[model samples]
Target chain A: MDTNQPRWQRRKDARPAEIIEAALTLFVDKGFAATRLDDVATQAGVTKGTVYLYFANKEELFKAVVRETILPNIESGEHLLADHQGTWAELLWILLERWADRMEYSASTGISKLMIAEASNFPDLARFYVEEVVMRSRKLFATVIQRGIDAGEFRPVDPVMATRAVISPLMLIKVWKQSFSLCDTEPVDLKAFARFHYELMMQGLASR
Target chain B: MDTNQPRWQRRKDARPAEIIEAALTLFVDKGFAATRLDDVATQAGVTKGTVYLYFANKEELFKAVVRETILPNIESGEHLLADHQGTWAELLWILLERWADRMEYSASTGISKLMIAEASNFPDLARFYVEEVVMRSRKLFATVIQRGIDAGEFRPVDPVMATRAVISPLMLIKVWKQSFSLCDTEPVDLKAFARFHYELMMQGLASR
Candidate 1:
């Protein structure tokens, strides 16, 4: 709805985002191997040829979908860490809260679940994700954790290992939402779970 | 190895275990939908008919594989909790250590990975796993946590949510081993990871 730009130019710019959105949904619903570019095109209301104009193949589209949808959350989390004037524990809590909020509502959250399910069949893509997304995300966390230690706000636990402890429950929640929680008559209270986990983590990390 | 029994009788008794093992490997390798009875029989060194005699179908065979291999670990863990007179922290650490040790050496560890990947395709199987394995496993952790709380050894966190915090890293490690870690030149040290996580959890849960 940006009338400032020429209609054709605006449409051209919007197409890739639309395609990525469509592809993300399909990849999450169907495993990565089973999702086709044609299905993504149809879902995006673009022709199959249009999908190719943006992405060379399904694999590229999948990667693009991940980068466009999931990586921004990490970027913003970094921004929160950089801009905040808060206690390390409070910053960690806020970061977890923001993450849990996004995960509660985002279709992109299913990407991790999809990747876990299909990564075995696509080792190259898996490696790309581990290097690009997983490692970078862990670094973002490790940075905050290290900051906490340097400030003498936290115990000097190994930041690398502590990062795993912090993020693993979040990762599990995402996967569970897509898989087993689908079948649960009384599904997990994700908000309560996240809050409790954050409290426990901060308590453990607190310097005596 | 037992000479007290007839060789044929012993062989007949061993066939089900062999079939379960074969089915588990196939399920982890090829996934449930793609694995066939004939292939499993071949892996077990039995006829397809012999597999059929032990298990009515693929679902039954998969369930038996889970129950036969994974449940005994849980049972033994339960026994540890029941017999332990140690501090709750020590008991929790031992449970995690035992669980991690089993995961390090067991092919059945792959069952959770296989289930996570294939669960959406087989909802009934997923539901069965959640109700049987997932819930049971959580209950085992919760019981220990509750005992700790009642004995004034730990803080009063909700046992179920705390249980998720305890188990999520273990679940993430299992899935990671099957998926992303396949490409890692430097694989995780499972023992060190488990040790750090246990230390953190107990520290967090300890009452002042």
Candidate 2:
């Protein structure tokens, strides 16, 4: 042990991250209403007081967990869109694929369910998630669509509506997978699904 | 009040329906974990014993409410599909449009949130919803797609996957509207949105 290190240094910076990870797992498994802070403390292998040092209460802990886990995921998609340039269809497909991947593994789905359950009472959290995460992601997609339209890589389309068109099916697929665990029935080749969605999105439903 | 009905008839039939209706409104507003049977009775203007006479517990009341509200909505869709015929694109647009209309005002969205929150703990309810509602709806869409494929209204396509593609976007739109209330800022014209979705569903991304 490094005895000379300050007390703050002794508690590794990673401890907060680790605590959030543990909290999310518990929240997803037991739900926000049912999960106790004691359980999270035990799961994180920290004293209850130590847990309190980082979070004021269970609701605060949940909000922190959601902010830490989901916001970055959406930001990463924005980062990708900013860094990459491709055909409109290709760019949209990449974003959709990334979204599907995130929903498949992340605790965001569970957090979303918890938010939905509590939104009538906790409208603030619902509004925060929508404004901070959902709308942010939608705006990013809309920007990409507008860019594509300007470049003539895509038709002159309503970027906002087009973004919804591109993203909504993927969102539904995630809900289906979460609500039904359809992922377990068989390995859905997501690449194929992505391509299928992309094709439907760019063209009208008319025979040549 | 008309008390001419047989004692068993009112207790067995009308009372249960009333209790379930009251439960649905309470559950939609307060959520499953927070709502009490006493609240349901108060909301219905009935005695606590009247609720217990119909439902064994809160869970039973929830299930009964879900069954009563959702089953009829789904059955109505089935009836609509059975009585109508058109081009695959036309029929799908109509079905999805009707679905969007039905979900707009129904308590199903709130119930769905509750189901997702509790599904890990109550897997039976989740399974019941998936099997009873989701699978059945998917089958109906697949039947329409198959008819389209046979009639040369659509290019050769996998009806199951096509149905998923056709319906998934609409489901996502519903989640977006209900969960985030995104439509408040930019209200989606459901008819036009459904038409756009249907057109995209029938065609691929390639330029005509």
Candidate 3:
């Protein structure tokens, strides 16, 4: 590994990435307000000056972490729509299950909780999350619903409304997990819940 | 006002309530950690020692506010369920609309945001909210669903699952109000959304 690296190559981009990774962990653990730049430097095993060289302030560093780490996961979720060739209900289920899987990780939960706590004070961060992450994801789901309505695979539902119905249940799982702190020890059985929710959403209260 | 006051009427309970009311206003404006007891005293037109005479610390004062102001709202909500006799859908709509109204209030938003920021460190507060507030509400809603199922008004859906379905869409409103700071200027058109949501929840994606 040493033989492959030139002295110039070693100093290029690795330090910034390392600093961000360390800062993310600290921010999640102690929260953004509580965690300081010196703490990030200590966690990253770098000098305060070196950390400052990469990022100007704690807010800037935190934003970079959000952009770098969180945004990529959302970007990758776009791929779920590409292979969606099944019935709208089938596609909705698959997408919801995929979303639940993504949400199951600790890093995602930590970031989400941190965002909820801080988003009020920092409107720009909240806007970035809504526009970049939430609206985009909802748009993808809405497109599938629109296709379903056009094809007569499902009822003549408002695609936007239907999209919210399909998405909201999965979204509430995060609220449920955090609010009640249920399923802390065990996994939430999200697949079972997803299937049940999908069935309830598809069929009306009136018996066929 | 002073001339009308009896010696027994002007008591400790009166002063404590006045202090709590002032503290709630300050805490809502400046946040829990940011608002000092001195500010509360000034707002109440009392000395700081007088404020301390009623409550031991900031946490106790906040708990008192939650117990007095917020918890009563939940109790009145329960009474709403008891007072009204309607179809499950109608009852559910009423309950959700009331919740949306509360979320739209600025003071409620401030207190809830403060709670989210502090809940990680103050797990007892979180647990109290879940057990006292959320679980009771869920159970009440679930009972309404069960009654609907028994009356053959709804299809044979699992009442617990149906309750989750009914509540899930409203979560979007709460998240939008709190996390994104939307729906603050005016009343959210919850009835329209509720109608749209409940229709899809009952009948599903199939076009009639």
Best lDDT goes to which candidate?
A: 1
For residues B9-115, write the lDDT of model 2, one tens digit per residue: 76666777778888888876666777899999998878999888778877778778878988787787778678876666677777787777876677666676666
DockQ of each: 0.76, 0.45, 0.42
Show model 3 residue runs off by greater than 4 Å. A1-3, A6-13, A175-188, A204-208, B1-17, B155-158, B182-188, B204-208
After superposition, the stretches of candidate 2 with alpha carbons farther than 4 Å from their true spots are A1-11, A56-60, A182-191, A204-208, B1-13, B52-60, B176-178, B182-189, B205-208
Error of 2 at A93 (Å): 1.7
Instruction: Tell me the spans in candidate 1 whose CA falls farther than 4 Å from its real position.
Output: A1-9, B1-7
Among these predictions, the greatest DockQ belongs to: 1
Better of 1 and 2 by DockQ: 1
Worst 10 residues of 1 chain A by lDDT: A182-191
Q: CA lDDT of B113 in candidate 2?
A: 60
Please tell me the interface RMSD, in Å, for model 2. Answer: 3.3
Ranking by lDDT: 1, 2, 3
Which is the winner by lDDT between candidate 1 and candidate 2? 1
Cα lDDT, all candidates: 0.88, 0.71, 0.71
lDDT score of residue B124 within candidate 2: 68
lDDT of 1 by residue, A65-161 (tens): 8889888988998899889898888888887888888888999988888888778899989988888789888888889999999999999999989
Considering the two chains of model 2, state its CAPRI-style docking category: acceptable
